[model samples]
Target: MSRPFLKMNGLGNDFVVVEARSKPFAPSAEDVRAIADRERGVGCDQLVSIEPSARADAAVRFWNADGEEVGACGNASRCVGWLLMEASGRDEAVIETRAGLLKATRAGERRVSVDMGEPGLRWDQIPLAEEMDTKGIELQVGPIDAPHLHTPGCVSMGNPHVVFFVPDAEAAPVREVGPLIEHHPLFPEGVNVGFAQIKARDRIRLRVWERGAGLTRACGTGACAALVAAARRGLTDRKATLELDGGELVIEWREADGHVIMTGPAEVDFTGTLP
Candidate 1:
């Protein structure tokens, strides 16, 4: 059976969006892998499916390139929001993910704003193996004689992230330490590792090593997690612009509702039909 799919990107983190709102299509692990195969299939960093939500909006299911279902996906949410608006003709909509409900709005010609909800800061919230403050946790990786990176802030944006604030993100060992930190013992569940460089009070640079997927162009939740980590440490303002490898994202930790609002662009690359 052939199915229609949309190729979209949020700051270059691409996705294959399948609209299954009318009926749920639960793709198996193998099926998901097949669909995300670069050469043999519809290829994407993630596969997003939109389904009917009990909360009066829509539910988005995310699968990584490895075919594992994930709790949250920021870029995918924007793509889902765009698809929902285009189909329903509404400027605003709510999307339900495994993490929680996210409010989104069509902010520009090809941009969408999503309220990513509140961030989780507790040790258990981040689900680390042992209890330690989210502010800083001791997890080292690299050479046993000379560890490269240590003491990172662990936070959750509906998913686990380990952020290491450095002086220069570009110089930091993203490729060297990212994979090690991601599989470190502290994180029972593998984590998305980020090397964050604070450029100014409201601007930062980031490079991410995703859990299920390796280094990607960008990661929205990773960016949000980084900003929250910085804000809690009094390092950055509540609102800042995150410069990722792929593009930029505006993140605001609203004092009123404690919700983290992520505003960025979502572009449709192309549409494909399943064979």
Candidate 2:
């Protein structure tokens, strides 16, 4: 039987969200690939499923376009949060995921703020093949004498991320080097690769090659990871505006509670029935 679904986007990082609170919706890898196919199906960066939760408002699952189930997706969480709040007529919503419980609140018109929780800075937390300094791991690409990208800060915002600070984000070879670093041996479980250019103490430009999703217009967790990594490296302040290709996200690594708060816009493109 066909199912109703919502098409939503946060900063242009789009998703196909299915409400499974009443019925279980488990799609196989092939099914997810077909659903996310650009030519034959409703194309999206990820497919999100919202299910009933005993502890939180709902439980959310994320699957990349490549059909791999992942731990978390910040943009999808915000979108789902908005859906829950609208349905319940409440200002705040809690959504559970493999990463953990996330709380989102209405920030403004069509805007939502999510508490992404604390970042994992340890090597084992990032889960590299070997323990190393997370501030700047020993990974490099391009010619050995003159590497194009090197010494990236590592952090885990639910999922593993590596942030490479470059002089110019546009000049960085994201498409060319992204896949290489994603599959690097150092990252046993693979990782999201981010190319960031620090615009100022409170601003940054970022592009991300999401694990199993390739390069997306925006990556919410990537933005949070970038801010945390930048702050740890003393490159930027704890709070910064991350400018992505699709739009901008405000990320703040709160010191008191050590939680990362991400504020951004969520849009509903349309609603339809899944074939």
For every model shown, what is its TM-score relative to the native structure? 0.96, 0.99
Please list the C-alpha lDDT of all candidates, in the order they appear.
Answer: 0.89, 0.96
**Candidate number with greatest TM-score:** 2
- Candidate 2 ranges with C-alpha deviation above 4 Å: none
Q: List clashing residue pairs in candidate 2.
A: none
Residues 20-70, candidate 1, lDDT per residue (tens digit)? 977667899988889889899988899988888889588889999998999
> Largest lDDT belongs to which candidate?
2
Candidate 2, poorest ten consecutive residues by summed lDDT: 140-149
Q: Where in model 1 is the C-alpha error above 4 Å?
A: 142-147
Residue 181's C-alpha lDDT in candidate 2? Answer: 91
